[model samples]
Target chain A: MKKLINGADTVLEESLDGFAAAHADILLLGAERKFVRRRTLKPGKVGLLSGGGSGHEPLHAGFVGRGMLDAACPGQVFTSPTPDQIIEAAEAVDTGAGVLFIVKNYEGDVMNFTMAAEMTGREVASVVTNDDVAVERSTYTTGRRGVAGTLIVEKMVGAAAEIGMPLAALKALGDEINRRTRSMGVALLPCTVPAAGRPNFTLADDEMEMGVGIHGEPGRRRVRLASADAIAEELVGAILKDLAPEPGSEVLLLVNGFGATPLIELYLMVNSAKRILEGAGITAARFLTGSYVTSLDMAGVSITVSVLDGQAKELWDAPVHTAALRWGT
Target chain B: MKKLINGADTVLEESLDGFAAAHADILLLGAERKFVRRRTLKPGKVGLLSGGGSGHEPLHAGFVGRGMLDAACPGQVFTSPTPDQIIEAAEAVDTGAGVLFIVKNYEGDVMNFTMAAEMTGREVASVVTNDDVAVERSTYTTGRRGVAGTLIVEKMVGAAAEIGMPLAALKALGDEINRRTRSMGVALLPCTVPAAGRPNFTLADDEMEMGVGIHGEPGRRRVRLASADAIAEELVGAILKDLAPEPGSEVLLLVNGFGATPLIELYLMVNSAKRILEGAGITAARFLTGSYVTSLDMAGVSITVSVLDGQAKELWDAPVHTAALRWGT
Candidate 1:
């Protein structure tokens, strides 16, 4: 593999060590590497926790800090975190209000987080994110798989929780944000899991996977390569068709990159997606564009749109000081 | 070849459109697509300006904002901005305090920015960065090539300018930081220019380039691929040899990815680099790790070490509000 890993077996733990060291001011590495928690907990505020498989760096772990996640439990590459990691993270961050779990809707992830919530005595709730409309069910998930939209849910709900939102309210807000958000991805190249030492799948140079999963699962279609405008059209078309937001509604547009795609392309996708949204009479009031959610070394992009109310917009604009997303502070 | 751009001929203009739209809150797209300027210029502060080839997204343009660059001129893919574009951008952002240009040390870029500085009527100065130690003279430059260290120069000088440092002092500060900083890059895969439609260079799956440039320019040597720790030892060894920093010098460590590398690998590289620095009796006082300065889609990374004195560290810690780097704001 043309990767920079020292050992495939220790990728997660070593990377977590580096991440914690780099962002020591904002992140506290949990004992035994179960999770990375915020350095300082906000007294009386609801604790926000999230996690999932690794490989998508800067997701749950990088989002842990002020105005975002209080703790994040990371699992092995493309594998869900254990129930123990989730339970310990929830217990560590829970101060007084409660702990709210922001979990992606995968079978393993849902099972583990659900088990943790049941086992923990601390008041706990979870918003299982299933915003991918590309598939009703996938190899790894029974329902629509949560993809890039999970980051949006975490940012929005994390902001709400920062201001002492109750656990119930934070959970409700997360669900509402997840409901309004949708994402679809396309891949030009496949990524390798470190241990596998090979690309998960293969595509010809002139072909593209239309609705690929983050972990390289088969998508809705594997078609001939299309221009960026056409790809944006299909992805945004499906999203708008499913969302069907009211005419003249304002929304936040997110053009996220899968691994290996550059910022220029991500921003270009944003332009294409924005034009489509404008054509549909929706105003893209705010924008977040980058490779925050990624498939490890996969060459592609995902476009996410979240219909925003005044409140959601305010929360997104709030100060956040995480390793991945930080602004306004 | 697989990049998500509308057309190779218009990649710069279209990507600029998307970048401006995504960051409308902080960026002002320049007329005739000459540059991207800050939405709100800070009066009386030295106008910090930078420009370079377009393929390295988020280097100059993404750094244009409150505490960083006042304006950034982006050329077409891997090409330097014309003198007219640079002249126009300098005039646009130059206030009464004058403008300071932070330029990377590529021949075309240096010549164009110098010509623009001579042509522009406004008071202007420049600090050409040449922090790369891989080759004393490479395919692109007469001296060492400026790699990821350019970002550090821009950041530190930009912070100094934000606090109303005069143009002369800012230029000197930039030069000093450039003197103290050293960087070296290695590429695991070659990148394709959109117009070229193929990889710029060839590398077997088992081989790697030791010191590749940001624009696919030839580096010092190629060898069989090795582990991340061995790579880190070689790179850090060369840097410390060139720098010969004091035994206890507190330095800022930047592990920057060349486009296709993921954050996990970058952080893992950082961990390796940090261990080496500690063994050399140096303290990595601060850290900035990301795919900040990238070759379009090259899978690799560059390590930058800038020895930080009190003033430099303070300036580095100062608030910066840009699309790529934001903190303490």
Candidate 2:
């Protein structure tokens, strides 16, 4: 297998060092036993803390900025951040406003973040995002694991907090966003974690896996790679059938490229998405095309749609400042 | 030239179609235009409109939520959105509050957004973000172009607007964010645009490109592929020299991965970055790691740092809600 960098073991540390040096504006609390918030907590604002494994960038840390997360605890690659680190971050970022923990609906992330929240003596509100429509509950696991939908929950809750909305309201908004948002993803090729140094899973040149997770985890099923049109049909069909948003309802269309998918493909998919939405009598009031959230270098795409209403729409239009996302004004 | 999609021509259209169908909540303006606010614009809030090429996903669009932007115009892959499309998006999201255009400092993006902003009339505020520290002004073109620094400006301006800050303040904040921020990027391997069906550039296994642009444009220089440590040193050195934040000052650290780089690599780089910061006696008050802004599947990373003061820090701490970033409360 071909790869860049020196050795897998040193990859994480070296990269983190580089990241810190380059971005001196953000404090880096190294990956140690206790990870502290790089920034001091404001006197009144509630400190919001969220984190998980390292692979999903811009998700945990990238979201850390104004109107968003106060502190993001990053674990090792694909592994949950230890409870100690999360707890420390929670404590560090907590202001009197009370910290709201936004945890993605992943087994490890849920468990770790939950532990951190539980350990915190401060007033803590937590929301678990389970918006991936592709996964179904079978009594064994949670209904649907949070995928790209987590972005919506995080943003809504973050905005609410930034504007000094009550924690309960923020939690409710987060849950509501999750309820309205659904995501389904497909993987064209398995991504090779630098540590693993090989494809996460083997697939024929023409094979693609649907409902894949970010950690190079297996998806629901694998199928022959089909035309972008066909793939769009399947993906959109599943999302539409699952969410069943009312026709004419406004929606946020996110055509997210997994790691390696090219923009050309994403645009093509967006084109197909336009036709399908028109045919279904649905109007896409907002369209987001790009890698808002990604899975390493997975070479695939995921579709996330959030049904918006008056309140949600307002919140969606709120301005935010962060390393990864910003707008408004 | 290994790829998973069926055909190159159909990629963008199909992806968009699937995206629209999945996101019933968002209104897809069809293939001819970009996305707009799903709900009718609030009667008095100035519309915040921004757009560019399609590759930077969730950028101009994902940020179109509350506390951020009003609309985002998406163009073809790596190509700036046409003025017509931007005009339509502006019209669609405008609520008589006027519109603010947050544009990255690229030739195409600047020209296109500039044209669109001019056509929109006097109420429009256009802020161009040119935060890249890598490129130096020569006899040829404008100094450095914008990079990940655009994200920071967007968020800051978005937050100002969300809080009812006047357009003047928003514009000032955008400009300030642009001034305080700087970025530099490197590319290890060339990325492929689906329609092109080939690599945008070529790099030997032992070679890496420095100072790369977002659209797979060639960098300022090329050198032997170095270790993550070495690469980080070079990148950090340039950025630090450019910004020259105080040694003991607090700052924000952003470690951005281009498309193909894995989380493991990002983490590794982050760790390395932390060490570099320590050596400089600088602390990152905020650190973000992820593939927030990407360039297709290009295997590379960029670092951005914003020197923060009390107000900047407070604003950075404000809560926000959007597709890509969430925090606060």
Candidate 3:
């Protein structure tokens, strides 16, 4: 596999250094290494924290800014952040209002974030996002792993905290948002980790994987590559069926691309989704089509939908500032 | 050439549908075909509008939340949004406070945004972010095209706008930020555009391209693979020499990965950047290491540095909310 750096070992640290130099507005703190909120916390506003592995760029860290997260702990490539690191981050960003940990539904993430929250002496509330609809829950594991839905939960909960909403209310709001969201993804190609210097999984020239995870984990199944529209139909169908948005109710659509999928493909997929939704008599009120959340170098796409109510819509409309998401002046 | 979609023709539309369904809190404004600020417009706050082609995720659109952009027009993959689309977005989001266009320094983007601004027939302030150090400036073009530095400019300017800063001041601030910022990137493998279904360029197994653009464009040169330390040193050397942040001056660092780079590799590069900066006596007050701005599936990294003074630092610290970035309460 081809890569740009001199060696694989030093990629993450060097990238962090570059990120710091480029956006001096944010602070990097903790020996364990965390992206801490730059603002001096107001005494009573709750602090929000989230994190995961490093390869999913802008997810945990990029989301650290106004109206979102206070801090984000990053782990090694495709590996969950250590409990010690999350604990350090939690302590550093926490103020009197407490901290909310937005944990994705992955086993490693859930476990690590849970451990860190438990270890924190201060009051902390946690919300787990399990919006991916591709996987079915078995007795052995949680239903579906969180994909892009974590972003909505983080934003909604962060906005509540920003306005001084109490911890219980914020948690409740997050849970509601989580309950209203669903996602499903398909992968075109397996990404090669720099350390491994090879594709994670081999694919025949015309093959693709459906319901793939962000870290090259196996998804529902492998299948022949299809047209963008058909793949989108499959993914969107799964998400819509899982979400089952109330008829005529507004919804938020997110057509995300895995790392390698081109924008052309992503746009085509978005077009397909519009047709599919319209055919079902579902009205999409807002659309965010891009690679918001991504798997490293995985050529694929994911569809996410959230049923919106007045409160949820208002929270979603709230102003936010972070490395990754910024809007609404 | 492997991809997950069923067909190329319907990616964008399908993706949009999913995005709208997933993010109902943000209004899609289907008839308008633009993402409007979900919040009721402040009576006299200037609307910030930005947009470009589809591939650059979390960019023009993701930044359209709170405290950043009011609206964004998304075009086809890697292509500039049409002038009509941008004009429509500008008109829809305008609340009598005028609109500002924060445009990256690409030829197509500059032309399209410029046309849109001109057609608005309203008082519109515009700032072009041109901070990539890889290309040199001449009378012929605006020098290096804007890369990741666009994100910083957007955040700072967005924060200013959120606080009701006048359009003139916001434009000045954006221009000043652009002046102090610089970026340079190298690529390991050329990314494949979905429609093309092939890599943009051919690379020998051991070769790398330097100074790559986000659209899979050719870079300054192609060279043999080097060590992470060497690559960091070279990229930093170019950027530092170009911007030359003075000794003891505070700076922001961003070691961004073009999609496909692993975190471990980024971390190693970050360490190398620190060493280089320390040797130069430059203080890195804040650091971000991740893939903030990304080319589709290119395997490479870019380094960015913003020289910061007290005011820039404060503005940077301000809270923001959007799809890609969120922080301070």
Candidate 4:
């Protein structure tokens, strides 16, 4: 594999080490180096923690800062962080206000975070985000998999936590956000697993895998590659079909790139998505476009739409300062 | 080529349209759609403008907002924007305080920006960043190519401009920044131009290109690929060799990924880079790591080190809000 790594076994540890060093002013490495906590924490404020596999960067760790996650536990590539790592992170960040766990709905992640919350012995509340409308079941997930909408949950709940919201209320707000958001993805190329030393799956040059999971898992279908406009339509169509948002409802549109997809293409996809939304009479109240979540070296795009209520919109618009996503500071 | 674009001819315009739409809060589409301007330009403030090809997303355009470029002109992929587009952007953003043009060192960019400044009929000054310390001469460039170091130039100069610095002073500051910064890049995979409909160049499965230009141009050498630590040593070695900062000097390190390189790899590379810097006894005052500058879908990494003074460091930390780079605001 033409990967920029020292060794497959050392990728996660080295990456986490680099991340902590790069953002020294904003992030601190936890006891085992498997978790990262924000450098500064407000006393007695609710702590927000989130994490998953290693490849989808700028997710849990990148989002660790003032108005986002307080700490994050990154597992090995495409693997869940162990309960011990999560529990350690929870204990480190927990203040008098308690801690909240934001989790993606992968079977391993769900189980691990749940175990960590129980083992921490802190007043911990949890929310499992399962907004991917791609498939009922996938390789690593049971129901729908959590996808890009996790970003929305992190942002909204992070803002609430920043304002000292209680753990129970934060959990409810996160659940509501997860319920209102939906996502769908399409992969133009397969990603190679560093350890496996080959692509996760074989795809013909002219074909694409639609609704692919972040782990390079099988999707709902594979079809001949089409124009970006068509791909946007298919992904957005799938998400909207599952969402059925009211005609004039305001929604936040997130056009995320699976790793290896260029920003130019993401913008083009956004253009196509905006065209479709305009035609459907839905207003995109805001848009976030970039590689917020990604599979390792996968060339694809995921479309996420969060049907927004006034409170959610306010929370989304609130100031956030993180290593990956920052604004309104 | 597996590119997510509608058509080669429409890539620039469509991407610009999407960028403007997605960042409508902070960006406004120029009259010709070849440029983007900040929606909230301070009257009488010094206007900052930069532009180049469309493939480098979030470069010129994504940096348009408060405390950064007042406007950006985008040309076709890997092609410099015409004098007409540059002139239009300068004229649109020019305030009574005058306008400053930041151009890369490419021949096309220099000639075109110079022509635009002459034709704009506004008080204009320019800075051509040529910080790549790779090959002295290469395709599309003369002395050197402006790589990721251009970001440091833009950030420092943008902050100066925000404080209402005059055109001459801003140009001098930019020139100093260019002189103090150095960059070098390596490519593991080549990028495909949408127009060409194929990879710009091919690499053997076991080979890599060092000092590759953003446009997939020939570099200093091609050799067997090595570990991330060795690669980082070579790149950081090249840059530090050109820019021999004293051991106690503070510097800002930027580990930029060419398009398609995952954040995971970039972070790993950053880890390697920090190790090298530490070995050299050089203090990395701060860091900016991401795909700040890209080469379409090319998978590679570039290391940029800016020898920092107190003033430059302060400018780097100033509040500036833009689509691609935002902080402190």
Best by DockQ: 4
Error of 1 at A212 (Å): 0.8
What RMSD does each model have against the real structure? Answer: 0.9, 7.8, 6.1, 1.1
Q: Candidate 3's error at B72, in angstroms? A: 10
Per-residue lDDT of candidate 4, residues A1-329 (tens digit) = 99999999999889988999989988899886968999999888898999998889878799999888999999988889999999888888987889889999999999999888888888999999999898999998889999999999999999988888888899899999999999999898988889999998978999999899998888899999899899888888888888999999889999999889999988988899999988888888899999989998999999999998889888998998888888887
Task: Order the candidates by TM-score, highest first.
Answer: 1, 4, 3, 2
Q: Compared with the true structure, what per-residue lDDT tens digits does model 1 show for residues B233-269?
A: 9999999999999999999999999999999999899
Which prediction has more favorable TM-score, 3 or 4?
A: 4
Candidate 4 backbone collisions, by pair: none
Query: In model 1, which regions exceed 4 Å deviation?
Result: none
Cα TM-score per model: 0.99, 0.66, 0.72, 0.99
Q: Where does candidate 3 chain B have its weakest 10-residue lDDT segment?
A: B29-38
In angstroms, give how far residue A118 of model 3 lies from its true place: 6.1
- Model 2 agreement with the true structure over B309-328: per-residue lDDT tens digits: 88777776676555556665
The per-model lDDT (C-alpha) reads 0.91, 0.71, 0.75, 0.90
> Residues A246-303, candidate 1, lDDT per residue (tens digit)?
9999998889888899988888888888898999999999998888888889999988
| lDDT winner, 1 or 2 | 1
Instruction: Point out where model 2 deviates above 4 Å.
Output: A1-6, A12-186, A193-224, A232-258, A262-296, A301-329, B1-31, B38-40, B93-97, B137-141
Alpha-carbon runs more than 4 Å astray in model 4: none
Model 3 docking grade: acceptable
What RMSD does model 2 have?
A: 7.8
